[model samples]
Every structure is written in C-alpha cells, then in structure tokens.
Target: MILDKEILAGLIEGSPYPIYLILGEELRVALANAATLKAWGKDASVIGKRFLEALPEIDGQPFEALLRQVMRTGEAYYAVNDRADLMIDGQLKTFYYTFSYQPVKDADHQVIGVVCYATDVTQLVESASNISRMGLEAVENNERLAAINEALAASNEELATTNEELTESTRLLELSEGRFRSLIQQAPFAICVIRANDLVVTELNDRYLELVGKERTQLDGKPIWDGVPEAAEVYAPVMEKVFQSGEAFFAKEAELTLIRNGLAEQVFVDFVYEPVSDLSGNVSAVMVVGIDVSEKVRTRHAVEEVEERIRLAVEAAEIGTYDLNYKTGELVGSARFDEIFGLGNGVNRETIIDHYHPDDVHLSVLAHEEARKTGRIFYEARYIPKGLPLKWLRFQAKVYFDANGNRLRTLGTVMDITVYKALQQQKDDFISIASHELKTPLTTLKASLQLLVRMRENPNTVLFPKVIDQASRSMDKITELVDDLLNVSKINQGHVGLKKNWFNLSDMLEKCCIHVRESGSHELILEGDKSLMVYADEHRIDQVVVNLVNNAVKYAPDSREIFLGIKSLGEMVKVSVRDNGPGIPADKLPHLFDRYFRADERGTQVSGLGLGLFICADIVQRHGGEIGVESEPGQGSNFYFTLPLGEKEE
Candidate 1:
C-alpha cells in the first residue's frame, strides 16, 4: 500500500503520540514538535532534520543492518538505555536512550524507509550538575517572601519530575514481569501461581498440567487443593507453617504413589514451600519447587531384592555365591559360600583363584572371559576343599550386566557334590556287576541250548555228551553268579568278618598268585619283602590280593607280567598289584574304585561286576589302612593297599 509523500507528511504531523527517528537510514520531520532542542547544547538544530543526516558519527556502526531488518520485516526492535556515542549538530555527546527501530512501509508492504524512536534518558547522567548547585544556591538567600516563593516553585517542579520517573519505572517493571512469565513458561519444571487467601490457582505452566495428569481446561479456575490433592495434602500444612513463621519449609524424601497408565508407581520428591510476600511485607501466597527421584528409588529397591534373593537361594541350595566389581577389584561372597569353602575371611575380585583345584583354574578363566565378552557367564565344576584332602565341591556362576549390556559383575553358587559323587560311584558299581552277572549266565545257557540243538540235528548220540558238558558249564556260571551275590550281601550287612590273626604277607601273596596263575594267561612276579607279618583278617587280606591279581589277568590278557609286592613299614604292611595294560583316563581314575565302573567303554559286558576294588578298599580301610590306584589312559596301572602290621614284625 503505497502512500503519497504529501499524505505521509500529514500523518506524521497529525499523530498525537511523540515519535522520533534516529537510525542509520532515512528519517524526516515536519515543523519540530518542541523548540527546547538547545537543552542538549550544540545539537539543537538536529531535532528538525533526518536522524542519519544529522548524526553522521555512527555511519560505520551496525545501525545499517538494524535498519534493514526493521524495514524489510516491518517489525520494531527495542532496547532500553542503549549506550552509544553520537554527534548531534557537530557536537559530541555521551547519551543513553529508550529506543526502537521500525519500518516505514508503502501500500504494497514494501519498505519505503526505516524509522527509529528514541527517548533520551540523559538527565540521569547529568546528576553532577544538580549536586554542584545544591550548597551554593542555599548561601545566596535574598528576601524571605521571595525565597519562600522560590522554594515552593522548586518543590512543585520536583514533584512533577518524580511523577514522571515513577511512570517510567512502572513501565520497566511491567516489562520485567512479562519477561519473567516467558521464562517460566519455557522452564522444564512445573510452575504455579496461587492466591494466598483462597488457595486458588490463578496460573500454571504447561508442565504443571502434565505433572497433575490433567489439562489446563480441567484445572484452571479450580481450587489448587482440589485439583492436586496429593500435592495439596503435603503442602497445605507446610504452606501454613511457612506463612505463620514467615519462613521457607522443606520436605525431603516425600513419596507419592499415583496411578499412571492404570499401574501404581511411586514418585519420590524433594521440595521447598516458600511464602510469597506483597509490598507491605505481608505473606500473600506460597511457591513450591519439587524434583522427582522415582527412578533412583526404584533402582535401589530392585538391587535390594536381587541381593536378598541371591543370598537366600545360595543358602537354601547349600551353595556359595560371589559378586565381584571388576573396576574396584572388590569381592563379595554369600555367607553360605564362605562357610562351604571355609573362606569366611572374605574374598574379592582378585581372590587368589589358584587356591581352587588346579584342574578347575582354566575353566574359571574361560568363564570369566566369556562373561567379559558376552555380558553373561555360566560355569560349573568341582574343586577340592581348601583344607581337606579328598573333599570336593561343585560350583556354578552367572554374570550380570548393565542396561547398556556391559558386564557389571559375576554371581555364582557352590554346592557340596561329594555325597553325590559317592552315590554315583555306587550306582555305577551295581550296574556293572548286574550287567556282567546277568550276561554271563545268559550266554552260558544259550550255549547249552545250542549244543542240545546240535545234538538233536546230528545222527550221533555222541553229541549228547557235548550238550551235557555245555550244561555243566552253564551250572558253573550260575554258581559264580550266586557267589558274587552273597559276597555283595555280606558286605552290605557288614558281616564280611575278618579273622584277626598274625599272617605272613609273603605267604598270603604266594597263595593269591597261585590262585591267579590258575587262569594261566599272565605271569605274576613277587616283589619286596620275602617275609612280613600283618595283623588283619588273614582270610580277608588273602581275598583282597586274589581279587587284585585276578583283575590284572582279566583286564590285561595281552600282557604277561603282574608284580605283587609286600613291604613292612614301622606299623603297616604295604601290598600292591602292578600290571601292564591300557591305563585309565585321568577323569575316570578318581572313580576307579567305585562299584560298577569299568575302565573301558564296554562297561556293561566287563567281567567281575566292578565291585572287587570297592570291596578291597572297604576291607583295607577296616584294617586301619589305606588303598589307592594311580593310572593314566594308554599307560599301565598300579593298585596299592596298606594294612597294619604286627608290632613284633614291625
């Protein structure tokens, strides 16, 4: 909308409000509004001229950019008390002004020129003039009536100036309030303004509505207490206390449980209720600020529950569990685990893992690596007890992680599997004996039936003798089965009685060797003492030796050598049977003496029912001695037992 120059000049002169332009660009004036321009000394002539042409000093300033922005956007830019140096009517001046930059737009919304508005506030900067005149004017008093008139005039002028300052101050205060409201609305925290008398909410920020789980329409003009009962209940008394005492009230760890999305969730808050005061120092209202701590509260509760469950599970399962912080090298072990490992002194992340069974150390390292890489760990193995020989335990572990999937720590349990080991051995023994005993008799019976069939098919009565021979063989096999059953029964009943008597170890070994030689497949060699006396059940010791030698011949038929040795120590006689055969695997060596365990894969068909070694161990232990074996796969095996020797022989 373009306007003619004549019409624009008319509007500029007719406008009732004061307007001035002082920018880097175009400005105009028609017949100056006030002629008090010389009040600024030499810049008096500049009032009736264009601002940019009258003040050429700021030509290199950013005023040009400011002018363009206002002209193109038709938006005014304002600043209070801008400090700048200016040349007015060729006189230098230090000035401050309340000012604005505005666009003089044509009819088509095109910028014709830039206009600036400025109100000089330089009177505040001229206070030196008033202070210098104060005392000198008091000393030049003339007639009393004249002086009184002068004083009254001065007082009236002072009142007029004060009123003008107050009006300007009020406008500045309103501007400040507007800025404060903008900042509050943009804040992340909920803000509210309430009336002190009725506790009514007059205004609230957007976040305040979200926090209350309601919309502004639902909450506006409502009693603050009615709209947010939980917050109201907490702050009502607190606000009263703050108002009564004219002090702030603080509440920490205040918890509020609210239903969110149909689920109950707890929020922890820390807040302050501060009484707001009016100009007269009277409490008018209260302001509350709160911080939510719900996530921290929930995390602490979850950790507690997890730790508790871990403790109980480990205790009840007769296991020990541990946790280690990799960063700190700090270790924590459950009480049950400490008791089991006898490491009650406590253990940590760097707890000497070498103290565990040597064979299990590598497994532990592997599990640790897996946990570090994958953020999860799982492992189980047996370890010998720290202070006890032949006592072992099984341990298992898991690794926990952070939300980002980083490994946080390890959790594990240890169980006492010693009894389990013993029970497993007994089961193996029973199965081995049962399979062998049943299979041998069945094989003999089948052989006998085959012989009879042959006899029936042949036209020779002579074949009947061979059938009878097969029947006798079957009967012999059945008798052996019956003997094995009786022996197992006696051992179970603790009735395998030993006739305690002085016996020559050599004589006993010689008899055992003779019986073993009856099989005729292997050679037996005697070693060590020729004559040694042992005080034991002579018959039981003889049985033990015979079994060992027989086992050697049966298990190692391809080998020809067996070594039988008896050595007299201070109070015991040591006996051993050594054979050259495929040695036991390391894993199975510990279980060699377990019942039903055969050294080979054909366990079900192995002879002797896997019980002879177990029985030997039991009898030797009963005689106040020990028995053990040492072997490795593909290597020969050696079985050794010790028995108390007669004092005279020792």
Candidate 2:
C-alpha cells in the first residue's frame, strides 16, 4: 500500500517543528505552516515564492545547496549547528538553526522533491559559534531497510510497517527541538540574559551587544554593571524587583549613560526586565529587551529647551502672551497678558475687540485681519480700561497652520510701552529747558563783563576789576561743576572712555603730595619703592591720587602730617594715602566712597558734589583694580588702591 500525500502532510504538519513541502524536482515550497512562516518573519505572501527567493537575506548561505543536494543524491542532509544570516527589521543578523533536509520519493521509487524540517538553534549556537561548524550527512538506515523489506509484503501487512516508520520520524523531531533553541534570539529587539544570583550576564544576542558597545567575550558571564557602570545605578533596583518578586519591570523613555567608543554618552531607551524561569518553576535569570530612543529623546529635549527660553524671554521683558483660536473665535492669555489688557483670563471675540481704546479699535481689527491672511502680525495699539490707567500696548504675533494647511491659530505677544513713551517725552523736555535756562544766565554774565570792560576808564571801574575777576572765577567753578555732573551721567550710562598709557605710580604720588603741600600747612610725605610702573589711564590715576590726598587733608585738618606710600606686589602695585585726624566712625566709613555720601562734617572741610571718591572707585574698577578704605574711630584712616603692573618693567 502506498501512503497518500495528504496523510503524510497531515502527520508532519501536526508536529511543532518548522516544516515545508517542496513540489517536483525544482523543490518549489508547496506548503509552510504557521510555525515556519513566523520563524522567517514572513507572512502568507511568501507561500508561492521559492525558499531562496523568500529568504533573500540567506543568499550565499549553505541551506539552498544542502536542500538541492538532498534532492539530487536522494540522501538526507542534517545541519547540527549552522549560521544563517537573516534580515530582521531591515538589519541583517546572524542566526543559527539545527535542521534536516529529507528526500521524498514517488511511487516508482525515484526521488521527486525534498522536505525541509528545521529547529531554530540560534540562542544555543550564538553563545558558542566559534566552537565549530557541525554539519553531518546521514541516511535513515532503519527507514530505508523497512521500505525495502516491506515493499514486497502484501498490501494488508504493510500497515504495521508504516506505523513503525512514522513513530521513528516523530521521535527524531522531538530530540531535535529539545537540543536546539528558539530563533527569537535573532530578533531585532535587544535581549540580554543576566543570571539571577550574581546578576551577571549569562547570554546576550548580537543586537544587545551592539547596543551597549561590548563584545560577547567581554560581557558574557561578567557582572552586568561591570561593563556599563552607568546602567548599574539605573538597572540595579528595578532588576532586583524583577528577580526577587518574579514580576516583570518595564520603563518607557528611560535615560541612562552608556559608554560608546570609550566616551560616556546618554542613551534613552524603552526597555523591560523580564524574569525567565527554569524547568523547576524557579526564576533563574533576568532578560533585558531594550530599544534605543536616544535621538528622539534628545530632539524632544532640545525643543523643550527652546520653548522654555522663549517663555523666560517673554517674562523678563514683561511681555504678555496670547493664543487666538480663529475657528472658535476665542482668545486665551497668560496671567501677565490678562493683567496688561485689564481683563479676565476668559478672552473671547468680544474682549479682543472691545478691550482696546475706542480710537484704536479700527486699527486693531485691521491688524487682526492682516495676521489671519498673511500669517504675520506687527502692530501697536492702545489698551484703555474703565476706571484704570491707559497703556500703549505693542502687539506682535504670527499665525500657524494645521497639517493640511488649514488656518489654525495665532500666537502673539503684548508689551506696555507707556514707560518708554514717558522717558522719550522727558528726554525731549529736558533738552529744551536746559538750553533756555543756561543760555539766559550765560548771556547775562557775558554782558555784565563787557560793560565792566567798557567802564574800565571810569573811577568806578578800578573798584570793580576785582569784582569782575571774582565773577569770572565763579563762572569757571560753575562750569567745572556742570562738567562733573555730566561725567557722572556718562559713567552711570557705562560710556566713560579711558586714555591708557604707562606711568610710574611712585612719581604720581609724589606730584600729588607736592600739589597738596603748596596750598596747606599740612606736611605731605611720600614713601615706598620708586619707579613702580603700571598700565592704566595715567590721567585717571592722577585724578584718583589727587582726590584721595585732598580728602585726607580736608577730613583730618588737625593731622598736619600725611603719608603717601606705594609698593610693588607680584604683577601689581599698591598706592595708599593715610591721614591722622579725628578718624571716621566705623558706620560712616563704609559709605564714604558711595556717590554723594558725606562723612562727619566736624572735621571735613571738603565741599563739592561729593562725587570725587565715587569717580575714583569707578576709574579703578574699569582698569581691573580694587579700591577701599581701612579706618578706626580714634586711629587715622587709610584710602588705598592697587593696579596691575604694566608691561614696561625695570
């Protein structure tokens, strides 16, 4: 009796092993079950395609040749552990499978086509592929012998012979499945197996090894954290949970530092730690499956930072933000925006139009319309609320669109320009007032001087010459004071210019002492090393020394003696002026250098705008130097400053 093809197919299809049927001599795959199709990561579309065509990733591999050889020679071929690089998720990866190719013969005892039976052994062989390539060609001695002996048997006697052959095939398939492993090991998803006890890596697929920048030899059987120290802190606690509790742990968009090419890099991943159990139902290992989303995470973070910076800029500028939904005719605003418009957060079409001043309503509508049509907004309008102050609001916005280019909404900013307007007006008014006030007084003084010159021939002119001289000196002092005020303004505006040149610090001190000595009974003394050179604005330093020495004389009139000293430090020089009078109080000393701050007047003979020390402080600071004072209640005070040494050094 000949076994029907349908019956043979039914027997093999019920087996769990991957099985495919080939037709005619071409070995075109006739049928492939769900298990075989899934292993290939293929679908029903591959049913009619040739086995080689279906798995183009396996081109140049030995499977095609082995299958054809089994058909050509009528001998069975078995692969113990084989490497088949297959395309998985667009990336070609190496996979190992243990399988067999057996010949199927026609009723005439001539080989027609071959049957392919496979068991995925990738996980088992990948861990130890370097061991050797174990491929063996074997013939089914028992099956062939039984086929020959039973060939001559009566048709009724052949049933038992067929039963014995079927039983042997089933036993072989079971042994193969048990010895090999799952093809899922070659999946694109990264998988790393860590032993439960030491949490050491016992096995990892190619994808996992590549993701972590590690070699199998370096990581297999090693502590998981030893290779990637960054993952230790992040994975330890969660892995412990999975191992001890036997519960799986999952994290989406988790970030951790990993070593890539010898540099620490941040990698974001979606991953899971699953507990794998042994035959005894005890959890033995933890498997890690991860997908790297580092690029996506970095892109998202960059966008978030840009958005945050925009938010901060708006806040710092005190600009208000708003979103206008054109479809819904609604306007929503941030808190500051609502404050600017003097309205509640529920801004709609009514408030957008009516909240503005009546005079600006027409201009606001025109701007809104233009923004909707052109996707850009640039306009300024007034916002006047009942019983509240009016403000000039500058409106700026841009429109956005949906994916289909449908008009979506507008995002805009509003800023109150009232203070800017007020300052501009004040600037204009000050110029007019100063010109009128100064010109009239100067003109009157000039006319008075001319009249005096004209009267110099009269007897009264002789008496008035001193008066004219005094008036001229008074005018010069007034002009100087005015220039000082202007200089103070320029310094406050951070526009003061310095003419820098090299000068000797000790010589400048001596000249300042000489000037003080000329007009006062107080003795002026200079000490310290001479010829100390410094890089600075020489005129500014001269001004600083003059102010310090004069202040010492004015504040300590009782102290006839003053000491001006200069010393050289490394790359720097120090200058100090010490005075001995009823010394400054501790509280008053701190404010002495502050602009317009006057010390105790009991001993101070100085009278001016009180900007001398303030200007000195500014001059020293601009040259990258320090200026301060040291004083006590009864002891005299010392005002000192230090300057960097110039390049010209003796």
- The lDDT of each candidate is 0.63, 0.71
Per-residue lDDT tens digits for candidate 1, residues 533-568, read 777888888778877877777777766998988787
TM-score of 2: 0.46
> Per-residue alpha-carbon lDDT of model 2 for 533-588, expressed as tens digits?
88888888888887887788778888999898888888888989899877888888
lDDT of 1: 0.63
lDDT of 1 at 551: 75
lDDT of 1 at 636: 81
Q: Model 1 reaches what TM-score against the true structure? A: 0.40
